[model samples]
Structures are given as structure tokens and as C-alpha cells.
Target: MFDEKNIWDTFRYGDESSFKLIFEQFYTPLFNYGHKFTVDDHIIEDALQDLFVKLWKNKDSIRETSSVKNYLYKAFRRVLLRKLSYAPQVVGFSSPEDKLDFNFQLGHDHTLISQERLQQIRQSLSDALKKMTPRQREIIHLRYYEEMEYEEIADIMQLSVSSTYKLLYRAIETLRNNLSNTDFLLLLSLLSLKKV
Candidate 1:
């Protein structure tokens, strides 16, 4: 596993290899995380690419006292928010269907998912997530899927630590209420069974 501090130090010292390592380690997860906010693949791709480029250009100025993952996520969130504000026309459409395929590709477990069942579960989860407010979904993703600390999440989300915990608590309650037992069970089963 890459030590985020070591990688950041290397990058700060002008090591090209460390930059490559960081990109390879984070690109897919960052892109998938970005997709939760928008269905446009190009937008997600562009946002992430731009973030990486900016990181590379500003490596010397970067100061991180926390995990590199937290830093990267915060940067990605900033880029996404800026894009959302700057290009409202590109991001304002509410087409849940547009993100369905990407959601499946990101979440599906090949070992557990037979072709048909995979498609069904993907659609189900995508629809369920679409029903959530963006903040709720973001809190859930950061807390559970990303396995981030509440303090780290609070920093990224610009909230107090207590508020982050409250947000996650409320989000989980909403998810539980909206998702049927079978769907919840299926998701939990997949998570437990899969290596992802």
C-alpha cells in the first residue's frame, strides 16, 4: 500500500514516479465518486483530470497534515463544486437514468453477479441513490464506502464534526426507510461477498 505522506513528500520533492503512483491509485475511485454527482462521463473525467493536473502543478505549495485520500477528496469536491457552479447547463439536468450504467459498473461484483442479476441490482441501487438528496448520498459514500473519518469528512464537507455525524445518521435512516429489506440484504451480501 502507498503511504500517502510518503507519496506527497516525493511529489513535493519533484519525483515523477510518485505522481504516477498517486494518479494510478486514485483515478478510478475518484472518477466513480464524481459520477455520483453527475451522469455526464465527460464532466467527471474532465474534473478529475483537471484536479490531477492542478495537483501536479501546485505540488510544492500543497500542505497536508492529514491523509492524502482526504486531501484528494477535498480537492475533487472543490473542483466538482466549481464546475457545477460554472456550468449549470451542463450539470443541472436530473436524469437518474444517465448514471445507471456507470453506477452498475462501479458497484457490481463480477464473482457474485450473474449477468441478469447484476443488471437488476445495479438499476435498483441507482434508483435508490437517485432518490437521496446529494448531501445525504455524499455523506453515506464518504462515511461507509470511502471509510473516511468523521473529522476528515467534516473538513471536506465544510461542516462541524458533530454535524457530519448527524448527517450520516440521518442519511442512513433515510436509506433504511427507502430501501426494502431485500435490497438492503442484497447490498450487504454483495459487500460481504465481494473483494471490492
Candidate 2:
């Protein structure tokens, strides 16, 4: 298995190869995480670029983190939020639903099942997710999709640890209530597809 601590230590030692590995491991996830907050590709790309650039520049001074993923996530969230604060109108959509941009894609074709059935499941999961409030959706994404710890999520979302757990629990409970057991299973599998 790949060890993040070892990779992080290597990068902190000013090894360019380790830095490249870290970037390759996290770029897509950071992009996806940022995309959940806003739809603007340019802003997300810029934030990611700034994040990596700063990481490389300050590698020697950066503290060793128990969870590098969590640290990066918190840093990325701060970068995006700070950028958005300067241009609040960028996310000035009237409703949380309007700001949502969740989409599900099937990884492969299923010969045993009709395409229509697959579509139905996909649609059902999407609908179920859409029904959630923006905060709820975010909590689910961080907690489930990102596999982040409650403390890490709390720090990123600016919530208390207890609040983070309650929020995630409520989001899962709401999703469970809205979806049938089979549909819930499909949603879980779909969300886990990319491991973030």
C-alpha cells in the first residue's frame, strides 16, 4: 500500500519526485472537492495551481501532519473560500439547489442489464442527492466520499466536531429515508467509484 506519511516526508525533504507524486495523487480529488463548492472551472484550477505552488515553495517549513489528505483538504477549502469571499457574487445563486453540480456516471456497460435500468438507478441516486440541502450534501461528500474524519471535516467546514457528526448523521439519515434500500446501495457504490 502507498504510504502518505512517507510521501509527505519525502516531499518535505525537497524531493521533486515526491512532490510530483503528491500532486498526481491529490489533484483530481482537490478539483472535485472544489467543484462541489462552485461550478467555475477557472477558479478551481487557479486554486489548485496556487495550492501546489505554495506547497512546493514552503515544503521545508510545512509541519508534518498526521493526515496529509486532511491538511490539504483544509488548505484547499480555505483557498477557495478566501477567493470566494473577495467575489461573493460568484456564488450568488438564489438557492442551494442552484449551486449544486453533482453528476453520476457509470463506469462500464452491464451486459446482463438493460441500459434503461441502469439509467433509472443513476437518476434515482442523483435525485436523492439533489433533495439534500447544500450543507447536507457537502457533509456527505466530505464524510463519505472523501473518507475524512469528523475532526478534519469540522475544521474544513468551520463546524464543531460534534456538529460535524450530527450533520453527517442527519444527511445520511435523510438520504436513507428518501431512498429505497436497493437505491441506497446503488448510491453508496456510485459514490465510492472514484474513492473521493
Candidate 3:
């Protein structure tokens, strides 16, 4: 049987094997999460490298956590944000927050749903997602796609628990207003936190 806490403890104690396990498990998820912030794959890779490097260097001093994935996500996000903050300024981009432009698509599975209707829903979902602010998009992605809890999201996003809830509410409301009722219902089923 696999034991995540044991692995985390060993990694914190400077075991290379445990660190490899932790790295392999979280790298892809961390990469995908970082992609939501910027389109530059190189920057994402560099930030991920920096994150892992820092973690490895500081392992002996790191505290064991109840949720390893949450801790990694929170740490990686901060590293990625700091990397992003140094980019060239764009028009209307007054700060690092303004640089965030989150966009995502809905992937359909189930052969039962017709391709044409699926395409329509995907378009509608994409359109609705585009209407939300980057913060709203991040909250929704964490809450739905990543299946994160409000507290986890609040910690990662540096917001209060109620703030994460409010952000999700606004995001869902935007989707509800933009998508047809049928598509909205379909969305609920489509976003059921698929096991990865």
C-alpha cells in the first residue's frame, strides 16, 4: 500500500527517493496549474525548476504537512507569481495581477452526447469562462478542475475562505448567465472532478 505522509516525511528528511516520488507526483499538476497564469511554456518550466530546487535545498527545514499536494500547490504558485512579476509591462497592465489572463476549455467524454451538441456546449463554456476575471477563473479551476476545498484554495490564492466562496459564486453565475439551461446542466455533469 502507498503512504503519502511517509513519503513526505522521508522527503523532508532529505531522502532522494522520496523526493523523486514527490516530484513525479506533483510536476504535471504544478505545470498545468502554472499554465493558467502564463502562456510561455519556458517560463513555466523555469519556475517549476526553481520551485523544486528551492524545496530540495530547504527540505531539512521544511515542516511536514497534512496535505502534501496543497502545500506544493501553494508553494509553486508563489514561485510562479514572482517569476511572472518580472515580465515586461504591457499596456493597461499596472501590476502583476493585471498580467493574469486565464482561459480554459471544457473537455467532453461520454459517447452518448452528440458531437455537434458537445461542440456547442464547449463553445458556450469557453465563452462564459472568458467573461470571468483571472481571479475568478483561478478559483473556479481550483474548485472544480483540481477538486480543491475552499480552505485549500483560500490558502493557495491568499484569500479568506469566504472570499474564495464569493469568487466561485461569481464565476458560476457568469457561466449560468451565459450558457443555456441545458448546457449549464450539462456543465455540472462534465465538471464532476474526473479521477486522474
How close is every model to the real structure, measured as TM-score?
Answer: 0.75, 0.74, 0.79
lDDT of each: 0.78, 0.80, 0.79
- Count of clashing residue pairs in every prediction: 0, 0, 0
lDDT of 2 at 17: 94
Question: Which model is ahead, 2 or 3, in terms of lDDT?
Answer: 2
Candidate 3 Cα misplacement greater than 4 A, ranges? 89-113, 180-196
Candidate order by TM-score, decreasing, is 3, 1, 2
In model 2, which runs have C-alpha deviations exceeding 4 angstroms?
Answer: 92-101, 105-121, 173-196
Q: Sort every candidate by lDDT, greatest first.
A: 2, 3, 1
Evaluate candidate 2 by giving its C-alpha RMSD to the native, one decimal.
Answer: 8.1
TM-score of 1: 0.75
How big is the positional error of residue 35 in model 1, measured in Å on the Cα after superposition?
0.7
Model 3, residue 109: displacement in angstroms? 7.3
Q: What C-alpha lDDT does candidate 1 achieve relative to the native structure?
A: 0.78
